[model samples]
Target: MNLGRYIRRTAAHQPDAEAVVCGPVRLTYAELDDLSNRLATALRGLGLIRGDRVATLAANRAELVVTEVALYKAGLARAPINARLGATEVAHMLRESDARVLLTDAAHLETARVAAPGTAVKTVLGYDGPSELGPGYAETLDGTAAEPVEVDCAPDDAAVLHFTSGSTGKLKAAVQTYGNRLALLRKSVMSADTRIGPGCRQILAGPVTHASGMPLMGIFFAGGCAIVLPRWDAEEFLATVERERATHAFVVPTMVNTVLALPSARDHDLSSLRQLVYGAAPMSPQRIREAWELFGPVLSQGYGCGETTSGVLFLSTEDHRRAIEGEDEELLLSCGRPLAEAEVRIVDDAGAPVADGEIGEIVVRGPDVVPGYHNEPDLTAETFRDGWFHTGDLARRRSDGYVFIVDRKKDMIISGGFNIYAVEVESVLHQHPDVFEAAVVGVPDERWGEAVKAVVVPRDGAALDEAGLIEFCAERLARMKKPRSVDLVTALPHNPNGKIDRRAIRERYWAGAERRVH
Candidate 1:
């Protein structure tokens, strides 16, 4: 039931194949396997046993990927820390996960050292340079042999602790068992949108710690090259795609928007791209169309979260082509059908199935689903019940089995007894000629209980007024569904994972108000 054995097998078969690339650093399959083996041996020598936690706080780099594979080989659970977390939050996660050692890089070494003292973190190892906390990364790996360590692990043993992005509330770790990870690998290899083999290369533009990292194993298992960019810049990404002849990439909607807005976005020779997979947030239909226009029909959409290990449903490249060709106009807004061996249902408050085209909470049952949240029994029991994990997203299932996400259950705004979905309004807002991006939230209102407000960022050098924007929505939607007020801003705030921060937007308008909607 070991997942590490798969990589070792691939390394044996194709030792000279390119495995990972970042900047000037490139590693063959043999080199990557040996480095991970040495690191695993070093961790074993440090008294780390099966089931012990090892945390990593580094950006997208070769070492981050190496440490994750090494942890799997050592039969240790990996607790990947978000590189953007504050010192206090870092300490909280270390204590909560009870990590034995913290593996960090030069960028985050000082913060890791500051957070290690008051937590269960006993040692700190940096990827480069001297560390005040313990030893350098190279120093720790010097004495270990470049051979695989055969550690035994059961299918149900914990393999990875995936921390939720916390866009809604406090962060929690989803305990992805070894079986769950195996299921992820199986699903990914079978997906039409993510499958890759030798001579294929994929560009990773987002932080690999979260959604962007989901397909790493599938690529490795297929003997494809993973080109890692240290940071994300629209121009740099396009240049890389042209230079490396990248065949695939995974990105969020926000990154797509940034690239589309670039003046030279269409000038690059992106003919080699076969698939552009997008997720982590709902993209407006207008933006998706723009992306399809700019990138041809190479766009696909994947829908999942940290709890599902990887995408449970994928909108294939063919699906995108169908929508673009106007065969199924409504399919443009769908997140596509559930993948193989997975069951998806839409249920109401009492767990009853809703009629087609009606909204409800999405519940999923599959081998890739996590068993529960780590160390939180009550919360786990509430979420995982009746053999299904209840996703907090609200969606509607169409007659053809396509699912359309409406909004987060908690983010829905009720104004004057009518429910308003933020995504629905934002989608319409994006269609305006002068509008670049928009976010909708519920603002406090004494008369209506809550008012729908829009924070808009207009296109550069475009003249737009609130009256005109409101009129556009009013003509397209019912009067009640239109935003009551609009606040034009230069840019919307984004969380660390690159999703729009709606909670921060709500705080600006709901301060000191005690209004609650039941």
Candidate 2:
């Protein structure tokens, strides 16, 4: 069945049930279905057809969810722009995706107005107000019919232009087709022990436009409720989880760290949370263990990029318990085995599989994987080859089939001819009593060609220095793999995707150099 039909079926089953709750706004399944139908009719009135592109530049709000369902009903592709991006970057994405319509809230109407002219966007609708850009979002839907749309879309028809976080360079769009979305929904609902059915209530703590919204379709398909937070505040998050009895939540490592450090973190009654799915970057095992101690064994980890439609590998709660209770400490570092029907391989440059425990490029083939980039044919050819998508991440597969991501192929440190995975060094650094966060990078060096450097953020009021951290790493890692220089900072930089910005850290030490590496 099509994605639009999934929600329609849910609405028919439980028309009066709560479908979405974003702060003061609460929408029933019937109301959500009717509103989306009106918006779809309005979009069709604007001359948009089955294959048109519509972009939403908003945060985790009701309008964003409404727009998504509307896009599906209207048979239009969605290009969700990151709300954190600047106007120029936002404009670049709109132009790249060739979006025909731009939708923004009151706060972002100015940016949308400035960006709409530089692209093929012919209409700008404000979700909150009637700005100079166009008519109000509600006004646009007022005169439209609340009837079901009948547009037919093939399984392979484009559904979403999901843009990458772009920490390294320009952002690229992964063309997520209707079939890919269906695959994602299937895996989520069928994943054992998830309990994502009627009465399931998941919290949207991060921007729903990105990874936080990946599982939303499955939740809607299962007739569950989605509670959205306007912005992430640790205290508010904990309070919401307690007050709403949130059943599931999706977060990154950074968010978890912040929530764990809050003074009142333990005060909330979080017994309602059954699963806390964490990913978007490599989380230190030390932090994961701490989380398990305070939050019970509900923590699950997902590993996938924008190209793979959110998650292809899932580290289940059972795996986390094994790590906490078993003697195999190494299992804690794995991202977990591939999901059902998904295949992952660790291959060398020649595309040959590597031996167990040997690091190699990660390639995946699955129904959920995106077709290719939006408009870049050469890049698409290079990334998607031989029926598999070549993820630039380097990883190693354990004998038990669990995959341990070593590092991004570009982020690996080549120091004096020795290969150092930054994740490995950072993992050791996290074991330190005083170190709160650490990022390792390779900087320019005259004699050794490249030197291993570390930038760190220490715990509040903790006494830590460069020499002490270096000595601590030397005890845990190889001599050459230890950081040659360590700099204590208040906080490390983060990219738009909430991952540590290692490229930004390298730029400071490698300034004036012709290239990043020797």
Candidate 3:
């Protein structure tokens, strides 16, 4: 089966429909289908065989979407590098994936040039224009003859080399297969909260090469328009939704915090928002309430990782209304029940199912779960055991089947003899009206072996001190869970996915310490 056939069918159905929009560039269904086919033909002409890898290192743009569809048509594995990565990380990916071709823009042409010297990258295609490193993107596609190119691929054929590094900072690629990707497309539309069809405009506001790109295939297959943000600015996001009449959006919690902080947030006409989904990190109950008020009953949440392909759990708009306007107040903390075709269970270390209200790891079994990592067999064996992919996340299932993520197994803070989840502490920190952002980490303590440290960023013009913030959390959380000390800073670092960089903040405190909790 060819994944690109879905796009071909959609194009045949609505040739003149808008498929993608970014900045000043807009491509109709005919244009997108034709360009991707031509680009696939061009890559094949360049001698890239099926299962060969093609890497792209660029920010959100119209060409990235084209490249994704092109790779699907060519039956080539996609290795998408985050644009925010430095030259060293980019070079590491080039070496690890051994990608034959690299696609980039003028902004990253120099970095690509610097990193492609001894790697397998034989050519680089520039999106903006021809550079010293490679030829122009538009000219290359224009030169190739547009044909209906679709390579038949097996179910287990590798489709995407999804690279991610959590707190450990070691990059690992999850080999997502063709069947897995098809499962992702199926699940995207099966859930009522994630469904998008014709006349549905979905805003992709983050880097499209990773988490933000998960919804693209479904949007294309369903004949929906994708409005890609050139860059992330809260005001620009609001304006784009109003201007494009966008009906759906998927954002990280950090992005939502920035939108809530905007003084004119309520003034914007966000009436077109049919579904506003947030994930990557848990949002505070207070922030959920604020977002519901701002976005007008469109807020929802999704929970998943690359290993699971995309989301396996979804908190729908009805769930949000039930929590915010109804009696299920604690439902605000749940990431929600299992989504479309996924089997989710909380299992102990021995892989035994845990009873309700018991904390354990979230193990998922589904067609969307990848087989294993590309080159790390040992790590793969450790993460994917038997038939279930271990999420390494600590969560508890309520009697009603709702799941609340306690924290990542690695992010749990061991203070004295107590197990304190950083997310639990951070949730209370977010309740303070003066706090804009907060990160909780465990630091070396001479007395307790390790102590909890809170790093907070106050809202604009809010005079919040460390004592006030610590006291606020103390009132809401357990005495042992309360931060031992608080640091009021201007901002907290974030990873490429818009999640708080607790690893970065914690590293500073444990840089040269003799004992470390993480």
- Number of the top-ranking candidate, with lDDT as the measure: 3
lDDT of 2 by residue, 131-190 (tens): 778888898888788999757889889999999888757798999998888888888888
Clash pairs, model 1 backbone:
none
Tens digits of per-residue lDDT for model 1, 295-323 = 88899988998888878877888888888
| Tens digits of per-residue lDDT for model 3, 213-259 | 99999999899999999989999999999999999998999999999
Better of 1 and 3 by TM-score: 3
TM-score of 3: 0.99
* The best candidate in terms of TM-score: 3
Weakest ten-residue segment in model 3 by summed lDDT: 165-174
Better of 1 and 2 by lDDT: 2
| Structure candidate 3, residue pairs in collision | none
lDDT (C-alpha, whole model) for all candidates: 0.87, 0.88, 0.91
